[model samples]
Target: MLPELKDISNEEVKLPESSKVRLFIKREDRIHPFVSGNKYRKLKYNLIEAASLGFDTVLTFGGAYSNHIAAIASAGKLHHFKTIGVIRGDELRSKKDYNPTLKFAQAQGMKLHFISREVYKNKTAQTFLEELKRTFGSFYTVPEGGTNALAVKGCEEILKPEDSMFDYICCSVGTGGTLSGIINASKPHQHIFGFPALKGDFLSDIISKFAMKRNWELQTAYHFGGYAKINNELIEFMNRFKAENDIPLDPVYTGKMMFGIIDLIKKGYFPPQSNILAVHTGGLQGIEGMNLKLKKKNLPLII
Candidate 1:
């Protein structure tokens, strides 16, 4: 498998006089023309392993507008693997009225299987995965958001010495996969932080068990109205931040992390001269679909 690494320049962003912080973005956002950022790192090892194990097809679970699904589909097509997306949502009665994300997945040749939210929760249940295996024949199964040991290995590659040394690294947590991977790969000197996008209290325990970081720090201040729900302030921040830096920030991932990071910096979370690295997990495709929803509600946008 040929791994493509994108070289991006670090931008030295200035903070307020009162804050006095120097911020540098690693630009994982520019990992690829389509499937970019942490998604590539998360999927690389898994894809290679699947191919090596002689798996001709790949099957995974995700929501109707999951970046994971988009990335998987994109990777499958690019890497010449058959793909199936067991999407979590009901099919619209109107056959022509398809969600944009589902449309994109289908366009990429991803066989779509709709499932109820209740049943979707059982994706990892032994019986369910076995049933899928029987139905689809032998195939590789990646958890939603590409969580696994292989995914963690891919994330570790992102922590090279050439990358800026950060006091703290922050990322949006979905299934606790990316954070868990980063934690496993990070040096003891660097700290890893997660902002849970879902409204659940048990994620800390999940992360603790996954990363073996019994004393790791977990913060829940920035769910911003739960999964996929965004308020005006978040929208405003995404727009303003993009305008100031010209960086694309989808509210679902990077936007929320940026909001939380800024709030943390303003609250004096970091001391003087301390650097922070915020991982930009890519979900830009969902932004187009989100805009369609927000536009109908007259919510303002930047891009």
Candidate 2:
């Protein structure tokens, strides 16, 4: 059976009278302890497809600290499938030879394959994939972040009409699969907004091209310091949002996107009466090492 949908409620966040926006956050973060939010959607069908094809192992790619890797490790353990994580970049030479993500993934029985940056960049090439097929013996290879057609199909479920009254849907964009899926599944009348956590250079065009259907609107102004980077304001906002709404957001991902959504609404991005929905794409574990980096940088804590 497919995983059960856990929580269902509209937690309203009130804005200033001038803003005239009422935001309701869909807590997909609470979906699962490890396989949470968009990760769940991304992996759901891919896992089933792999099993049906009689594949006993799944291999995927990601950075040193990737939510995708964590999810795959957890899902593999739960479903009795072996997992291999092809991590980019070499192991650190300076500091202690340890990364929390890598450690946890190893603990979960996920074999790690570290590759040089240049080699990692060729991950999309058919030749490289063929090499992996030969190296890893037989396995279903899922692209980095599970950003593929099947993943987009799974995220389409996120746009289902809510039983409650709401008019808009918003969420952070990583590889754009989640947004693409939601946009694909959303009703024509409903407005969909995607807050890109990356620089706007060519991400919009890239996502737009992928989403050839041209059914949704995507914005890229709130990346803050770009992917995997965080700032004091973002950290403070994350802490405050959690304190007020009991919703935790990771600074490197959902927190930044969320801060942008609220800022845009407050700046007249949306009408006052409009009801907005924001998705919480889970990446809590990714924050572990980044948080330590922040603390070491002597950045002020938001506690």
Q: How big is the positional error of residue 278 in model 2, measured in Å on the Cα after superposition?
A: 0.3
Q: How far off is residue 1 in model 2, in Å?
A: 6.0
What lDDT would each prediction earn against the true structure? 0.78, 0.80
Candidate 1 lDDT, tens digit per residue, 205-224? Answer: 76666685542466788998
TM-score of 2: 0.93
Q: List the residue pairs that clash in candidate 1.
A: none
- TM-scores of all models? 0.93, 0.93
Across residues 37-59, which tens digit of lDDT does each residue of candidate 2 receive?
89999999999999899999999
Q: Name the runs in model 1 displaced over 4 angstroms.
A: 92-97, 212-215
**How many pairs collide in each candidate, listed in order?**
0, 1
Error of 2 at 29 (Å): 0.7
The reply for model 2, stretches above 4 Å from the true place, is: 92-97, 209-213, 301-303
- What is the Cα-based lDDT of residue 143 in candidate 1? 86
